[model samples]
Target: MISVEEAKRLILENTHVLDPVEVNLEESLGLVLAEDITSPLDLPAFTNSAMDGYALRSYDTEGAHEGFPAFLRIMGIIKAGDTANYELKNGEAIKVMTGAPVPPGADAVVMVEHTEVQEETLVVKKEIKPGENIRYKGEEIRRGDVALLKGTVITPASIGFLTELNVKRVRVYRKPKISLVVTGEELLAPDEEPKPGKIRDTNSVTLKFALSREPTEVISVDRVRDRKSAIEEKVERALRESDVVVVTGGVSTGDYDYVREVLESLGVRSIFWKVLQKPGGPLFFGRKDLTTVFGLPGNPASTLVCFYEYVLPSIRIMLGKNNKFPVEVDALVSEEIRKKADNKTHFLRGYIQGDGKHLHVKLAGPQGSHMLRSFALSNCLIVVPPDVTYLAPGSPVKVHLLPEVFL
Candidate 1:
């Protein structure tokens, strides 16, 4: 078995960052930027009112408070999206609606609720400072400044900013094409009635859901029987057409483990066979051309673990992402953890419980790699090194978060 560091080196060998592709702004959300985006025009475009109030020159509000109100002449009212038509002279104010451009010579605003208005006169109770309640031009984004940099994952707020800059499209790294293959002589299609000794295929469904979370286009999924020739053909096809090939089962040293031989024959040189990890100890990885090959264990939990710890990052690197590791959180162990001490790695299914600040983790039911039901109930993966003999309750442990938009 190889150490985790070695495994990472093997994965990154022969890999290069993906190039950028032009895409419409609508399709660029959640995608990584490949180039810097500088704003061509000032954000807010021009000075505008931030609230419904009166626009006044900075000096007019001196000593204008509850006791000393600065009375001034009322100019015209300006609503949102309207250009400037009224101007503010000394000791004069104009009613300005939110988002309306501040008229020339105006440097401050006092909310209407703070002032009493007569037919053509204005009464201000509280003092207002210059630039108060005003959104100055270029306040949000300055022209020729980098609004967003390369390697940034675009979010909704980013899209809104880009739209404000009149950016209709952007350059984003293209999604990697991934090929999935499941091999077993006893496996049958999910919808097919299984004959004696045959089981419905589950690996494909697992890979589909896992890969769907990434920016990838699943080239195709092939379910082949445990035949060496067929496996070779499929692996070769993956090497030729896909950026990454993920195969479930046939990584262990069992008699039916033909994937290793097939991959080697198809020029997918093995980086290492077994990894020093639980649930996914049987994982293997390889590389050929620009395509990465992951030999995932057949067990559901193990497959998912290998995918997240390794394959997921491989995809991100191939997509030109600068950072790929998922966010890790610290949580107190809610129960005693039993394990043998060593240098190996261990991953246990767990669920996190906490109120925002401190997250506590309790192991989810079982830790068996082959059990599928336990995974459905798991919300996190409690990581334990082989050297940890006993993790007492309340001990701090790192937990890899799960996709729990529902949790």
Candidate 2:
């Protein structure tokens, strides 16, 4: 078994970023940009009014106040999207709505709330300065300006910004295609009633849901009986079709465990077989050509933990994301925890509580490998290193916030 850090390093060293693909702007959300996005045209496109106000020369409203206001003739009304071809002369104002183009020769805008319209006569109650309440062309983003840098993750705001810049398509790292193979003879489908010796198959659904949180394409999810031939056939097909293949069960040493053997038979060189970690020690990582395979433990909690620690990072690296690991934060433990000084890292399900000033993390419930209820209730994983045997209450610990917690 290798250390967790060593296992992570090996996985990253072997993984390569996927090639960039030109996708429609609507399909780029949650994807990392492979190229810098430059603006094709200026944002706003023209000088427009920022508020529903009257556009006029600043000199026309000089020294104007509620006590003694300046009155000017209203030229015409200009609403948003209307062509403002009219020009303002001295003592003339244009009633312009928000986002409407300001008429020529109008250097300032006075909000309608500060003035009143009386029978086509514009009342400027407040003194207006030059360029007031006007959104100028290219003020936010000029043409040819780099609106977004490479490696930036696309968000909803990014979509709107790109659309504003007239970017119809974006170059982004292609999302990795993944396939899942769950191997266990004692596992029953969720819809089927469980027998005395069989249990419901939670790994398939749980793993699929977890994978959905990432920018990945889960092409297929196959459930196979615990037989060498069946496992081999499914593994071979998954490896052939997917960029990443995640197989749950049949990895640990048992009478029916045959995933490791099957992978080796298919020429998948094992980078590592296990990690020095709690809940998920019997993890397997290997690579064959351009495809990477991860054999996770059959236990639901262990499968999810290994996915977050190992598989998720590999997928992110392929997507060209800079931060491949889960978001980590420092928190104080709410209760003391004791365990043997076994040289293995422990990931305990935790719920974080805030007291307005500090963050305190407490165990969600039982820390069993097969337990799914605690994992479901948890928002973070309290990381404990191998060297530490006891943690007193209020001890600082590094906590990894789960993916769904942010969602």
Candidate 3:
């Protein structure tokens, strides 16, 4: 077994980032840009009015006061989206709406609130300065300007920015295709009737929901019986087709275990086979060419923990992301916990409280490897290093905050 840090290093070192591909801007949400995107045209494209008011020369509004107002002939109305061909002559004003292009020869805008409308004329009661209430062309972005740099994750706001620039497509790292293979003979589907020794298949469903937040496409999900031939056939097909294959169960040393053996037969190089961690010591990682494979423990909680700690980071690296780990926060334990001396590190499901000075966390429920109820109530994993044996109340601990997915 290796340390968690060593396992992560090996997984990342063995990964190969997917090649860049052009995708429609509308379908590029949650994808990282592979190339620097420069603006094709200037933002705002033209000088337009920022407010609904009258466009006129600054000299026309000068010396205009509340008591003594200046009157100017109204040339015409310039609504939004209308081309302004009329020019503002001296002592003349054009009624312009928001986002409407300012008429030629107009250098300022007077708010309608400060002026009254007369018959075929506008009564200016306030003095306005030049360049007031006008959004200039190329003010925000110039043509050919680098609007978004490479490795920038496309978010909702990023989509809006790209839309404003009229960007049609972008080059981004393609999402990895994933195949989930659940290995076990006694496992039954959720819709099946309960059997004496058979349990429902929770790992596949849970993983599918958990992976919904990631930038991946689930190409196939299959359940293989606990037989060498069946495991080999399914896993071989997965390795041949998908970019990443995740197999749950049959990783530990058991009579029926065949995941590790089948992977070796398929020419996959084992980067690491196990980690020095509780609930998931049998986590396996291997690589075949550019394809990656993860052999996760069978238990529900163990499967979830291993996915977050090991498999998720590999997927992030495949997507060309900088940060490959879950968000870690400093927290305080709210209860005492004791463990026997072992070489494996412990991660307990916990619910965190408090928001200000310090975060207080308590165990969600039981910490057994097979327990899934505790994980359901947890929002984070309270980390305990391998050397530590006792944890008292108010002790400082590193918490891996679990992100909310499939919600």
Candidate 4:
């Protein structure tokens, strides 16, 4: 078996970023941009008013105060989206609303709260500074400026900004297509009643939910019994149609385990068979041409752990994401943890709590390969290296936050 770092390195070395595709701006959220986005036009394209006020020359309101206000003749009203044809003259003011274009020859604006109008006469109660309450053209972004760089992830604010710039489409890396194959003979559907010696199938449901969190397309999800022929047929078809294929179960050496043998028979070259880690030691990774495959353990917790550590990174790399690993943080352990020092890494489900100054973590519950209760209640996976046989309370440990918790 190889180390966890080695396994991850192999997976990334084999993966390649997908080609760029032009998609509509409405459909580009959560996608990484493949090209730099340049502003097509200036933001706010024109000099406009920043508040509901009267636009006039600064000299017209000089020495004005509440005790002795300066009076000027009202020209006309300029609302937002309306073109101003009349220019302001000396001792003249125009009633301008927020976002309205400032009339020509106007050097300042006085807010309406500071003045009162009487018939056609305008009252200015405060001294107005030049260029006050005016949003200058291109103040935020100028034409031909690089608004967003390549490899930037699109967010809601990005969409609004692009809309203002009239960008109809964006070039982004294409999302990868994936397929899932679940194998087990003593498994029943989730809604079906469990009979004697049979349990409900939770891997398919959990894997589907986990895959939904990534920007990937799951084309198909197939369930097969512990039969070599059935497994071979599904694997071959999935390899031909998908960029990545994840098969949960039949990976370990058992009387009925057939995933490894079937994968080899279909000409899949195995990069690695196992990793030095608990909960998912019997993981399998291989490739055939451009398609990658992962054979995860049958246990529910093991399947999820393998997916989070290995499969998720591969998908992110293909999607052109710079950070392909889960978010990691260092926290102090709340209790002592002991293990057998078997030269294997252990991922324990734990809960993290922050006390303003420091972050403290504790085990959620039992750390069993088959149990999902603890995994569901936990927000992070406490990573313990092979050399660590025991950890005392208050010891620092690396923690990988779950996708739902961090994303």
In model 3, the runs with Cα more than 4 Å from the true position are: 63-72, 119-126, 405-407
lDDT of 3 by residue, 318-377 (tens): 888887888888888899978778967888898987767888888999998889999999
Clash pairs detected, candidate 4: none
Clash count, candidate 1: 1
| Higher-scoring candidate on lDDT, 2 or 3 | 2
Name every residue pair that clashes in candidate 2.
none
Find the candidate with the highest TM-score and give its number.
Answer: 2
Off by over 4 Å in 1: 193-195, 340-343, 355-357, 403-407
Cα-based TM-score, every candidate:
0.93, 0.97, 0.92, 0.93
Looking at candidate 3, the ten consecutive residues that score lowest on lDDT are: 398-407
- Model 2 TM-score, all chains together: 0.97
Residue-by-residue lDDT tens digits, candidate 1, 17-134: 7778999998877789999998999987999999999999868778888888888998788888888976668988889999999999999888889999878999999878878899
lDDT (10s digit) by residue, model 2, range 1-407 = 99999999999899999989999999998899999988889887999999999999999988999999999999999999999999899999999999999999999889989998899898889899999999998899898889999999999999998888888999999999999999999999989999999999999998888887878899998999999999999999999999999999999999999999999999999999989999899999999999999999999999999989889999999999999988999999999987778899999999987887889999999999999999989999999999998999999999999987742
State the lDDT of candidate 4 residue by residue for 349-404, as single tens digits.
98987988888999999999999999999999999999998999999999999888
Provide backbone clash counts, one per model. Answer: 1, 0, 0, 0
Which has the higher lDDT value, candidate number 3 or candidate number 4? 4
TM accuracy, model 1: 0.93
